[model samples]
Target chain A: MFWMTWRQHRLTLASLAVVFLGLAGGYLLSGAAMRGSLSLEAVQKCFVGTPLTCPEWAGVISTDRNLRQTLLPVLPALVGVFLGAPLVSRELEQRTFRYAWTQAITPRHWLTSKVLLLGSAVTLLGAVFAAVYRWWFTPATTGAVTLYDWFDVFDQGVLSFPSACLFAFALGVLAGTLTRRVVLGMGSALVGFLAVFLPLAIWVRPNYLPTLRVDADSYYSQSGGWATDFVYLDRDGNEFGMWEALSRAGVTSTTSFGSEQEELLARAGFREMVDYHPGDRFWVFQLIEAGIFVALAAGCVALTFWLVRRRSV
Target chain B: MTETAIAATRLGKRYGQKWALRDCTLRVPAGRVVGLVGPNGAGKSTLMNLLVGLDRPTTGELDLLGERVGPNRALDRVAYIDQEHTLYRNFRVHEVLKAGRLLNPRWHEQDAVDRLHELNIPLTSKVGRLSGGQRAQVAVAAALARRPDLLILDEPVASLDPVARRDLMATLMAAKADRDCTIVLSSHVVSELERLCDHLVVLDHGEVRLAGDIDDLLDGHRLLTGPAATADRAPVGTCRVVHQERAGDQVSLLVRGAPPAADPAWHARRVNLEELVMHYLASAADTTGGGKHPAVLG
Candidate 1:
């Protein structure tokens, strides 16, 4: 069964390997050049004190960053489209499932073998890509890229890529089983990946842990935390909206504020409060998100088996 | 070994509100070449699907080779060839045989390879590129290589040319003779069934209309031509009239179960397999309104 599955998908596997090798090779070549330039004395000095002094090195850094930001997000969707959608839909569309399901091996075993083999391949590919991406972005140690923030692509590139790949693979299998059309399955799987990913990234991830509140004066001093919201507190520590406090201070436009007005407001027992997630919680959030995605993938796989068992060929 | 290869009691299958097969009670004895004859919508495919455990019965029980029909067990001992001869089009001929070897525990690899070679089918060619007759042969070779106890073919030769059909039947006969396995072949072509099968099961209106040894069925049924005045009157003796026709002053009756005592008034002749199947199917259609229109008979 394993050999048959491998033979059946040999072309798909070869294409995926070529694409992976191309991306990895590109990343390695450009990453080495960026590392070589970042090690120069001028670039090192500029990183310590000056801005816009090393235009050549800065151009290389910005270009690499732009490429990573654009391409990393698309990796999971590629896995969903190529590896996951066609697993079952092709058999159904071609009517080869009639031969497949009638073999001496039961349908359950047939599905299990395919899912295990392909799902492992996808996860392993994601892991390799993640490792290479992490290596490529090693310049983050020089304080060039914000690697620890939840919103940064580094989090998605490192931990979330494999998790998202697993989830997308399962989603594709479910969509293929339901639609019984390869193209439609691929489309739905891509849409499903975005639908689940965007909402969680935007709304659910920030609240996975309790937010820390600090005085506005120390917001900038707390450099490793991701600040999300601001509030104003009175003398008794009663919280109020920043807009309400600004309006009460006779400041019509909060964006333009004089230093004297800021001093006055501070002396009047008005303290600004900042809400943020500390940098140390980055791994915690990664684990939480990965867990959620893995659980959803398992659910989709179970549902796929149930659907296969219930429906007639 | 069990005497019966397949035994179904009130087997039925329904798709939403419509029953594709209903109350289909049948018993096919082991080691006989049985022909399942039915028209386009006579539930032939549905019954075959159920027998192969591709679809579950909605109403009753079905056993294949003394074991309950199910995805896990029945498929181990039974091989099925669907009407379309479904195979992976992307696979080469040899790869298909390799798949059969990988999937079936009892797969006979050399037999499949030899059969395809004997037919001059190229092993390196993709199945999608093969002609319809070649694909059908590949399907048969794959099924036979499994060495199953019972082989159920669902209209496998319906689209083949006459020569290809004859070759396929001859191959099937060779396989049956070699392995001594029971075969249930379904087809709408009565003449082909007459040539290929010894036992007959006539299905119409989703029910088994006639079933038994072909010779016994033929011996029991007779075509009687007599005067028109005697047609309305029931035939004497144990024979049950199945169909009646009138032309001018002569009346013809097709009866089942017994041949009446020789009376000089009526001319009685033994019914051939095709005529016996047609009369049974036509009568079944008349009663249930689900088979070929009876007007085709006239």
Candidate 2:
């Protein structure tokens, strides 16, 4: 049954090959670009900034690392949506599920075998992609990768992506079974996939980890409306007070608060607290999300089986 | 004990407010090719689906090969070919046969391959590339290769050309000759049914209008034509009148039973299987007033 399912998805396997080649080529070119810009002197210069003096935001040009890190977290999701859409939809669209289901096997058996076989393949591809990305970026981040990245790259590739694909596939199967039209199945799968995904991406992730920030000076200024002078203290215990003298003294700067009247005090010593670091914790989170997605996929699969077995066609 | 190939007790099915099949009690022993015949939407496919456990029945019980319908065991012994082409178009014919082998515990790869070769179907040719008739043949090959205990087909030849349909039917007949499998096939092509079937079941408006051995059903039934007076005064014997039409004093009546001894007034002739089936179906359709309601005939 597994081999039969593999044969059934031969096109998908070919698609996966295309995906792998594309990812690999893109990674190689991007790595070459990053390496071209990275000299030993450049690395030293990046770390040789004036300490605890002023906001260093000016020097932080959005580098390839930054872009890759930001984009990498969401790449698997798009892949998930794309790869998952055709898992069941195309078969149903072509009226082939009826053939597979009526074999000397129950609907559950048929579905289970396909899910296991295809899900494993998707997961392996995802893990390999994630591993490759990790190898390329490990020199810089050095294991600081977050659960978000792992889930986005590895866990989702194997677990969540496959689950989503299964969900979409089952949805397509149900639509096809009921409507007996492949177009309806494809359309419903797209609509349903987005309906489940967009909301979770926009509304859910932020709430999952609540962050509380306290701007002490802003609170002080609000409570006691004083036109205070900027105070600057060096790491060597040298101190300067008042606005013009503070400017000469360095170590602190005032930036405009949006397009507002009041100037906001920006401190240089402390960077914003990052809630979750990239690494083991991220993997844990990925496992949890994967578990949830797998559960949902399993539910959809069960419903699909019930629908197929009980359905008239 | 080895169970009957298929058994149903008051098995029924409903699609929302509409009932597709009701009070369908059938027991088909192994090793016989039974033909199910009906017009469009006459519940023939519905009955086949129920027997093969493709669709669950709304009421009563169904058992296939001793296992309850809907379980894996029942499905393992049963193979079904629906009215539509079921083979994946993207896969070559060989892949479809390989799928059958993987799916069925009692698969016969050699037989399937040989049959495909004999039918002139290229193993490497994808189903999508084949003509409609060729695709239908591939579906038949896949289903038959499984070597199942019970094979249920719903309009398997609906899309096939005459030659392909004849070849498929002959292949199925040969398989039956070689095995102890029970076959229940449904088709609107009554002539083919007449050629292939030993037993017959006729369905109309989701009910069993008539079901029995073809020979027995035909022997007991006769079409009688004569004057109204002669027909009315004729000995009834073991016959029951089913349909009647009158042209002035001349009347024609369709009855089910043997001829009366030494009867001279009435002209009694045995009906051909196709004509007999058409008569039952026409009467059934009329009884339900254009097939809106269900009607059962014994």
Candidate 3:
């Protein structure tokens, strides 16, 4: 049964290997080059963000590591659509499952072995790529503070990315089993992954640990605002945004909260309040998110397994 | 194990609200070639699926090779090749045989290789590139390699050309001569099963219309020719008229059971497999008020 799985999926596996090697090699070269460029003053200046003072740093950063950040999701999506969706649906759509499921190996054993081999491959590669990403990102901040936002760190982190790969692959299998058509299965996997992923990242990840509130002198500094979002707190410790403060000071949009609003904010003793899941909580969030994703992955796989056994034509 | 290769009692399979095959009670003694002959949508495939355990029965019990159908019970004992003879289109021919060797605990690898070699099928040829005949042969080779006690094939040559059909049948015959396995295959073409099967099953409207050893079924049916005016007047002698057709001044009546006591008024002879199947199918359609076109045998 394992031999049959290998024979059937060797082509998809080889292509994925080529893509994985290309991405890994490309990231390694770019990350190493960036590490060497840290000696340059301009490179150091743009490390925080798009510093207007250094056009060369902006050019390099934008053209370089920014792509790697966005490319993280692509790997998992490929695993889901190309690998997982076709695993069952192709067999069914092509009418080959009629030949396969009738062999000496039952459908249950056939699926179990295939998932074991392919799922292990997905998880191992996902882990390796994630570790490479963490290595690539570490030098940008020099271990002092985060240069990107919490979401960026959370996305390219070591633990959660691997679990996300498993989740996508498993969801793909579930979609393929339910849909029983290749293109439809691939589409469902993509849509399902996004449906679960966006909400989890946007609404759920930050709340894994309660936010730590801190008062910062500057509202737009790399530490207080870039890494975390901040709102204004009045003398009464009431949180407020620019709209409330501007309206209270009678500053219209035409004034753009010019010096008049600033004066009023100062008089009211309004300070920038930063609510953040601190850097120390990064791993804790990773652990929690990883657990949720793995559980979801298991759920998808369990459902797929049950459907394979129960479903018939 | 029981000598009965397949014993299905009231076996039925339904899709949605309609039954594809229903109330089918079939029994085949071991070691004989069984032909499941039917027209399109006659539930031949459905019955084969139940026998091979590819489908769950909607209504009854099936015991194959003396074991109940399930994930663990009959998988290794039965080998089935479906209508299209589906294989991994991307894999080379040798890889498919290798998969067979690896998947089945009882596989005979050399036999598959030798079978392919005799058919002059190249081991390195990709399955997608092979001819339909070659694909069917390769599928048969793989199925035979498993050394199954019972082999079930559904519409094995429904799409093959005449030459390919003859060639695949030859391969299947050779395999039968080489093994002690019981083979049950379905085909809509009556001629296809006439030369290959000793036991016959006729399925129409999702029901078994006629089933038994071919010789026994033939002995039970009689074809009578007489004047059109005398078709109803002739002594049928405990025989039931199955179908009647008139050509000009003469009438041909297909009867089941004993002939008209060898009357001189009519000529009586045994029915062939094709005529027997067509008569039963035509009579079934007649009973159902044109449920199926009787010309389906064409």
Candidates' DockQ values? 0.62, 0.51, 0.59
What is the iRMSD of the candidate numbered 3?
1.7
Better of 1 and 2 by TM-score: 1
DockQ versus reference, model 3: 0.59
C-alpha root-mean-square deviation, each candidate: 3.3, 8.4, 3.5
Q: Write the per-residue lDDT of candidate 3 for residues B28-115, one digit (tens) a residue.
A: 9988899998889899988987777677788999888887786444378789998888998998998898878777888898888998
Off by over 4 Å in 2: A32-82, A134-194, A216-295, B1-3, B229-233, B291-298
Query: Chain A of candidate 2 scores what in TM-score?
Result: 0.58
Evaluation by DockQ, superior candidate among 1 and 2: 1
Q: TM-score-based ranking, best first?
A: 1, 3, 2
Rate residue B171 of model 2 by lDDT. Answer: 80
Query: What does candidate 1 score on TM?
Result: 0.91
Encode model 1's per-residue lDDT on B75-194: one tens digit a residue.
Answer: 777888888899998889999999999899998988999999999998999999998889999999999999989999999799888888889999999998898899999999888877
Off by over 4 Å in 3: A33-46, A49-60, A142-151, A217-229, A235-238, A254-263, A269-271, B72-74, B226-234, B244-252, B291-298
In the range A171-204, model 1's lDDT, one tens digit per residue, is: 9888888889999999998998889887887788
Query: TM per model?
Result: 0.91, 0.77, 0.90
Which is the leading candidate under DockQ?
1
Clashes of 1: 0
